[model samples]
Structure formats: structure tokens, C-alpha cells
Target: MVLDDLGSSLRGTLKKIANAVHVDSKLIKEVVRDIQRALLQADVNVKLVLDLSKKIEKRALQEKPPAGMSNREHVIHIVYDELVNILGGSRELPIKKQIIMMTGLYGQGKTTSCGKIATYFKKKGLRPALIAGDVHRPAAYEQLKQIAEQVKVPFYGDNKEKNAVKVVKDGLNKFKRSSDVIIVDTSGRHKLEDDLIQEMKDIFKATKPDEKLLVIDAAVGQQAGSQAKAFNDTVNITGIVLTKMDGTAKGGGALSAAAEVGAPIVFIGTGEHAGDFEKFDPARFISRLLGMGDIKSLLEKAEESMKGKDAEKTARRLMSGKFTLHDMYDQMDMLSGMGPLSKVAEMLPGGFSGKIKDIDMDDTQNKLQRFRVIMNSMTDEEMNDPSIIRASRVKRIAHGAGVENRNVKELLKYYNMTKRMMKGLSGNRKMRKNLMKQLQFGK
Candidate 1:
């Protein structure tokens, strides 16, 4: 949830403007100032912010409002457009049979990102193979192998081979027939050293990758720009993969850096799992940043994580108010693929702040871990029919899940309460409409 503060703050500023009847000089100044403040605080590039504000001001003051559109709506549209423009437009990764090379500093999650990238392509029906060219770290090869197994993608790496260039060259020839996408995971340096940069250049020459992606940790904040510059100087990076965005407040910084470097973000890592990677969508991302709803993006994330017909059926049930404990369990299983509850909550249309305004969502990782354990302890019949779980069964299930009997009962109680609530809300058309709209648009 990088740049998370921008949404609420910008909304507050816009709300003040909406209260005004006319867009005068004073109102324009106030709006511009508010936007500037929010952007700066969110760690957006200062020059970019100034240019965006100028465009927004120019448009708001000079451009004629569309017929039937109020001044407020007109102003909001201009602001949204400007923000999206600065955030960059939709750019999709090419899915053709080509080699993709990953570059970054050590410990920036490049190794993990390579596996995720391979998995992403694999999910698109392309057979991808990962070549572990990173020979610096002793465990790098094994890590790639483990991730490859988890993602079920083919892998080629030799722990015994010290020469990364030779390994990649050999891997390219060996896996050429079977793999459509060859991702060469190059070595990284703890800092920008000449030797490491030269090594990456050598690997590039050997592999001749189609795309060079710089994997950067979102937590690097302002340094992200400098790091991008350093890597860009050595290797021509076509795109970026921002990793660990879920835990970083400086995701905005990394994104701004990508924008500054003229590199579009291709994918983002929200969690540690192989399936937790998501394609970067500018419109949905800008909407999320502005605290406007990003229902489309949220749904896309859900679909990517869940995969296949089960995700579709669950989404249909959610829309139809048929969400039961059984449905909740199914949703939970999908959520596991998506990432942590906190990360998923942040990606929702209204972001985490709006969604959890009234409810005390227990988003602690330990809580989710416990819930997962409890679900595993349940029999298939029990999962579908919670009412069958009596006191004795609860105790046994609690022991199986490694929690107290009270926790098991509490989960069932919550599930039952949620089911009843959904049932009651299902009967009211107006309420359902409002709920759907809220879920869809965060309105």
C-alpha cells in the first residue's frame, strides 16, 4: 500500500473543493496546494508533482465542462486524468517466445522475482524456464530450484558452475526447445561495483535477453531512483518489477523512480508466494492511490491469484449474496494465493482505511495462520455444514488445529453470523445495490 496516504488526503482536499459553488482563483489555488502537499508527502517526484498540478490547474480553469457534468465532476475527472498520466499508462508485458533478463542489487529479491516472473508467464499458457545465472550467492541456485518446483516451471542452474555467463549460455541452448520464455536470473552486487556490473554486461551479451527488468525493493524509498540510474547505466532496463510492495510505505518512491527513469512497472510482488505477483495496472493503481474505487483491478488480482473456474464461481456467489461459511472457506483458499489479508485489503477499491473504518478486521498474520489451521482441521462435511460441530467435535477439532476449543467455536460463530447477515442483506434490493456499488466502486 505505497502512497496510501495520498488517496484519503486528496479526497479530503477534493471534498473541500466540492463544497464550493464556483471554481474561482482561491479555490484553484487551494486545490493545487492540497495536491502538492499530498504528492510530496507520498514521496512523488517534486517536478512531476509541479507539472501535474499545473496541468490540472490549466484544465480546470480553462477547459469547458462537458454537458450535464457538474463543475465538481469536471474537476475530479481532470485530476484523475492527470494523476493517471503521471503514473504512466497501461503497458503489458510481451508474451512472445523470448528471453527476459532480471537485474538488480543483491538482496533486492531478484532471485525470487525471477521465479515469480516465470510463473506469471506460465500462467499465461507459455512454458517458461528459469536459468539461475546468479552464482554469487551459494543458495541462489537452490532457491531458484525450490521456487521453480513450487511454481512448477522448468529450471536450469548448476551450483558447481562458478561462471554465470557459461551457465546461462549453456542453459539457453539446453532449454531452447522446451521453453518459450527463458528468464535469466543474473547475479547482483550488494553495492554498485564495477566487477558486478561488468558481469551483468557479460551475461547480457551471452544471453541476449529480449527484456531486461530491474527488480527493486519498494522499501528502498528515495534510493530507488539512484539504484535504477546505476543499473540503467550498466544494462538497458526495459521495465521494472517492484518487489515487497505489501510491506513498504515507500512503494510510491520506487514507482516514482520507475517513472523518472522512463521504465514502466511490469509486475509487482505483494507477497512471498510464487502466485502473489500481479501485473501493474495504471488506472486501477491511480484509483487506489486517489482513494477512488479500483474494483476492476481488485477483481483481476483475485482472479490471477485464484485461477480457473473456482475463482469465477466464488466471485459470482459474492455478487449474488450467496456467501456462506463454505463460500468463505473457498474465498479464504483463494486469498491464500493472493497474499496476506492486510495486503489484499489495501488493494481493494477504497483501500484499507475506508474498508476497515467500522469493523475491527483482525489482520494479524498470526490470526490468519490460526484461521488456516482451523480450516484444515475441519472435515469436508464440517466445512460445508458447521452446525454439525457439537461441543465434543469442537474440542477435537481445536486439538487438531492446535488452538483452544473456544477459538474453534468462535470461528463457527463468526461464520454463522456472517451467513445470517448476508442472508438478511440479500433480501433487500436497495441494500444489495448499495453494497454492490460500494464493493465495485468504493462509492
Candidate 2:
């Protein structure tokens, strides 16, 4: 929620354009000033903000709107594209067999990110192994080992070993044949100390890792650039990883600072949970940041929750308007797999996401669980067809689910709402067209 306010600020600025009948220089300047203020508050470097604002202004005014697009749309596109560039253009790390070395100042969440990366690779069907090369930090190996066990991946660590390079050597040899990706978690000093740099150099010589990653804390703000440069001077970071993205209000600073260094960010830790980690897609990130839900990311998380023939079959039924309580239950249950309710809401475009902000995310999640429990108490025939569930059935189901009869009625209402919304999509041409327009306008 750090950049949440920025989205509102940007939206308010852009909303002015929506009301304007003409695209004028005055309007452009106003929007640019609003952006500058928002970025500055987020701790973005002043010069970088001014430069980016300049580019946005020039493009919005000088460049002709694309064919069939209005000036409002064109100007919004320019802002979106420029912001994406400022956060580093889309850069992907190919999922393949490789060795990655993790380095950063102490307390950058390097160890947690190590587990997250390994878990991410494992989910992608790669056999990932973690090497605990951070012998300096107490319980560092234990922390990663616990994560490895939870994610069920191979892990190698030696707590007593004083030579960090030896740990990397032994870990590589230990999982050479069994692992597709080997991640070396190296030690970090409180600051950029000589000993820590030398230790990293020693590990670099020992393993010659395929990629060196610098895990950065998003709260570091403008200092992120200097930290990135210092590490890149040594091992030459192949990519950057930002942690605690969900908590920091100065996330814009970290993002812009890292981009200033021209290092492509590979992954971002949105929350403390390993499941909250996601690949850093600049375009989608900017989309979410601007309040124009990231549907692509939403779909990706959806696929993770429900897959194979069951998911396919459910989709078919919903499209055909054959939705049932069972279908609703499965859909809501699948949502649990997608990090948090508010997080998932941010990926949906338009008023829907704004509505989510007004509600309690945890309370919503708890209600979803209650819905699932209520449905579980229903008979197969009743779940398949809700019409048969009269007052008697509602009372019985509620009693079984440990709730009042009114709760059952509320669940039925939610199911009907979902059914109508999903089924109406087939006939809602105007709604679909409006959504397309909003998505193009950055919502």
C-alpha cells in the first residue's frame, strides 16, 4: 500500500483530463505538476522526476494521438509508458539451469528472498537448491533451511564453517546433478564492509555463479542507487530484487533509484509470505500502480489456483450460465491461493477495485470461508440447483455451518450476484466495450 496514494494522486490528476473538453497546454502542465508532487513525496530523486515529467509533457503535447485515440487517451499512454521506463523496462530472467549469488547489506531480506526464488523456480517445475554461504549471520542457514523444508527443495549449509567460499563449493557439488537452479546465499555486513566484499569475491571465484542478484529493501529510498552501484562495482549484479514492497511508502524511490542504475529488476517481494513473491513486470506494475488493474497478473494467479480439466470444465459451465453453489464455492476457494483479497482486488480494473478498498479485506476473506462452509453443508442436488433450497433448507444449512439462517440467504445472494455477473458477460457488449476503453485509458 506504499504507492497506493500515488495511484489516487495520479488518478485525480488524470481525472481532470477526462472532464476537459479540450487538450490544452494548461491541462498538461497541471497534470505534470501533480505527478511531480506525488513522485517527490514518494522520495523519488528530484532531477529524475523533472526529467521524466519533461518527457511525458513533450510526448503528450508534440506527438499526435494514435489513430482513433483521443488526446486524453494519448496523454495517459505517454505517462504510463514513461513511468514504466522509469521503473526499468520489462526484463525477464529466463527460467533455466543456473547458479545465482545473492548479495546485499545486512537486513535486506536476502535469506527470505533466497527461499522465495527457490520456491518460485520449484513451482515453475525447476528443481532448485539453496546454498547457505552466509556463515556470518547467526541462524541464517537455519532460516533458509526451514524455508527449504517448507517448500520441499534441496538445501546445503554449514553453520560452523568460517570459510564462506567453501560452503558454496560444497553446495554446488552436493546438488550439481539433482538441481536445475542453484542459489548461493552469501553473507552481508551491517554496512558495505571490506570483509563482506572480500567474502563475496571469494565465493565468486569458487562458484562463478551464472547470475549475481542484489536484494534491496524498498524502504531504503534514494540510497538504493548508491547501494546498487557499490555492489555492481564488485560482482556486477545481473539483476535486482526488491523486498517488502507492500509495506514501504518510499517504494517509488527504491524503484526509480534502481532504475537509475540501469539494472533490470527480476523479482519483487510484495509481502512477507513466499506466495506473495512475483516476477517484476514493469508494464503490469505501472498498470496496478495507476489503479488500472493488472488483469494479466490476475489471470496468472487464477491459473495457479485452479488448473487442468476441472478448471476448464468450471469455466465452461460458468460461461454457459450453468453456475451453481459448487461453482461459487470453488471460485471463492481458488481466491485463497491468490495472496490477499486486497492484493487480488488491485488487479481488477475500474470501480470494482475501488469498491474493494472501501471494504475490509480480512472480513471479506472470512466471509468467503463462511460461504464455503455453508455450501459444504448443502446436498449435491441443492448445490447444483439453489431453487430447491427453501426456508427449511436455509435453516438446516445454516445450523450445520454454525450460523444463522440469514447467513445462508446472504450466501445465496452472493452466489446469484456472481452468476449474473459472469453469465451476463456473454450479452453485455456495451459493458465489455467500456471496459476495453477504461483499460486503454489506464482506468
Candidate 3:
């Protein structure tokens, strides 16, 4: 979950509202104060925080709840909308032939972001190429070269060439004919020095990039605004890419600061992994942050992660009430590929996701792994038909997997429960129809 602490705090405050005996002026003020503390602690700008709180308070007090909504629900809605506005809305970058120039100070994860952004485009069915334009740093060329290979995209760089502008020009020419999207990882400095500005100017003039993105570290807090303005002044920055968003308390500061500069946060790097990059959509971001869930993004992740897998076949098997451990293993693998369970949970509706958060995710993940291991120790007969896994077989399987016999029993119990549920769903016409439509199974 990105901004884990802030999300938890906000959810706690909202829970207070949900549990309140009555919705009144006093309750509204208390909720407003709680929100103020949460936003301030998350490093949001003081003025921005105050302004947001005031708007929320005014709306909650002055406005009437909708016909279907209660006062508490209406107040929560106001908070969600205001938070989204402060974070700024999504910036659309079309998938087409264009050059993107990435710039930022050194240690802002700019180089790695080039790779992640390239992966993002590649996943979108676009051909993206990487250009190593950071000439001041000796390792930038090799690092980006490795990243290009990792993403299986064409790369251009002249490590011996000290002229950053010339490197970009040559690289653009090299990949211009073949690549759909060319991303140039420009040079950075220790500070916004004169030479850095001049080099960036030269590169900007040379490439005529369609998008000038400034990568900012979310941990920079309020200072990110100054950095964003400085870079924007230098290159007329078209967008911002926030890195290190996961688990950062100061992410709110970076987000709001970037928004204040009027450069939309086009993307965010959530973690160290190459797959951790995501398009920044303020409404969806705040939705997840407030535990409202972004079903759209969740479905998108599922479609992307489950690619090449036989979802239709699995759906048919499930509908036929023939779900075996083998089928369950495949399902688990698909879930794991989608990313961590915590992240997926964050995309679920508040009511359900909150319950999931109570269970230790680490323990659950380990248990999933343990279940897979236990299944691996079973014979095809046992895996396909768990009814044959008697007491003696359980002990032997547990010993093979280096686990207690009870672990095997637990796996069997879980499997039986899942199988029974599948059987029930298979028999329900309306539920089955909806499930198939949602899964797009057997399409």
C-alpha cells in the first residue's frame, strides 16, 4: 500500500465517523481535527491542509446529505473528493511515437525510473527504447543499458561521449525509426547547478522531447515543490514522476507540492521492483488511500498479470465443480504474479479490505507458500482427489514437505471448503453468469 501510515490514519478517522452515535457540528469538528492531524503528520503543506479541512468542514455543515446517503457518508465523500483535488488529477500520455526526456537531481531514482517507465509502455503494447543521456555519471550508461536489456528494448548510449546532448541526438536517430516511444534518461547533478541547467537546456534543444518529466523523491517532503519549480523553470517540465511513494510519510508533501506547481503527477514508482510503476490517477489513488478501492485499476492489474494463462479453462473447470489442488495452485500463482496481497487488498472496498488487513499478510503469504509445498508433496491421485489423503498419507506428505501433519490437514480443510464453495457457485445461474462476465471467462 502506498502511503500506508496516512491511509491507516485516515481510515481510523473515518471509522470514528462511521461509529458515531450522531452526526452533528461537534462530530464534524472532531473529524476535521483528526483529518488535520493525519494530513499534517503526512507532511502535507500547512496551508493546503487547512484549506482542505475548511472545505470539508463547510461542505459537511452547510450541505445536505443525498437521498441515499447519511450525514456521515456525505462527510466522508467530501473528504475523499477534496483529497483527490489536492493530489491533482491524472495526466494522460497517449501511446504513440514520441520522445520523453527525464530529468532530476542525482539520487532521485531518475535512471531507474527510465526503465520502469519503459516497462510501463511495453506492457501497454508499445515499443519503448531507452537512451542513456546522463554523461556526468560514469555508471549511468551501463545502468540504463542493463535496464534496457532487462526490459528487452533497444538502447543507445556512448559511454565515452562526454557531450550529453550529442549522445541523446545520436541515440534518438538510432532508435527513431524503430521505437514507438523513446525515453531519454538525462543527466543530473548534486544540486541545480549552472552546468546542469545548461546541459539540460542543450539536451532539451537537441531532442525536442514531447514530455519533459522531472522525477522527484517523495521523501523530499515540502522541499519537493522548490525542486519541481527549479526543474520546471529550467526545462518547462511537462509532468512529474514521483519515486519512492511506497511507505513514505512525506509522499503527501511531494504529491501536493508537485500539484501546486501545476505539473500533473503522471506516474509514481511505488517500490524497488521494475513492475512497481503505475499511472498516477488522483481519484483512484485517493480511493485506495481511503480504503474505497479502485476496482478499475484492480481489474486492469488482473488482466495484465493473468495474460497467457488459461483463465477460460480454469473458469470452465470451476463451473463444472472439478476444482482440484492443481487448479488452486494455478489460481494462487496468478494472484502472486499480480503483486503482493497487501497491495491487492488496498484496492478492495473499505468494508472488505479492512477485514483482510487484520490478518497478518506475511503469515498468509507464508501459509500460501506452505500450502503449495504440501501440494507438491502429494501424488497426482491425492492432488486430483484429496479424499484419498488419509492419516498415514498426511503424515508421509508432511514429512516430505518438512511440516507438521496438521499443516497438511489444514491445507486439505481449506481445499475442501474452496471446492464446496465452487460447487455452490457452479449451481447458481445468476451468480455464475455474473462471475463469467466479471472474469470474462470462456469469451
lDDT of each: 0.75, 0.78, 0.81
Per-residue lDDT for 81 in model 1? 89
Query: What does candidate 1's lDDT look like per residue over 40-95, in tens digits?
Result: 87777788889989999999888856644545567777888888787665568887
Best-to-worst order by TM-score is 3, 2, 1
340, model 2: CA deviation in Å? 53
Query: What are the clash counts of all predictions, listed in order?
Result: 0, 0, 0
Error of 2 at 405 (Å): 83
Maximum-lDDT candidate: 3
Residue 401 miss distance in model 3 (angstroms): 77
TM-scores, all candidates, are 0.63, 0.65, 0.66
lDDT per residue (tens digit) for residues 240-352 in model 3: 99999985889999999989988888999998878998899999889888886533333345444435344555555656678788777756654344332344344344664
Which candidate number would show the highest TM-score if scored against the true structure? Answer: 3
Per-residue error for 55 in candidate 3, Å, reads 1.2
1 versus 2: better TM-score goes to: 2
Q: Which stretches of candidate 2 lie above 4 Å from their native place?
A: 293-443
Whichever of 2 and 3 has more TM-score, that candidate is: 3
* RMSD to the hidden true structure, all candidates: 24.0, 22.4, 23.2
Cα lDDT of model 3 overall? 0.81
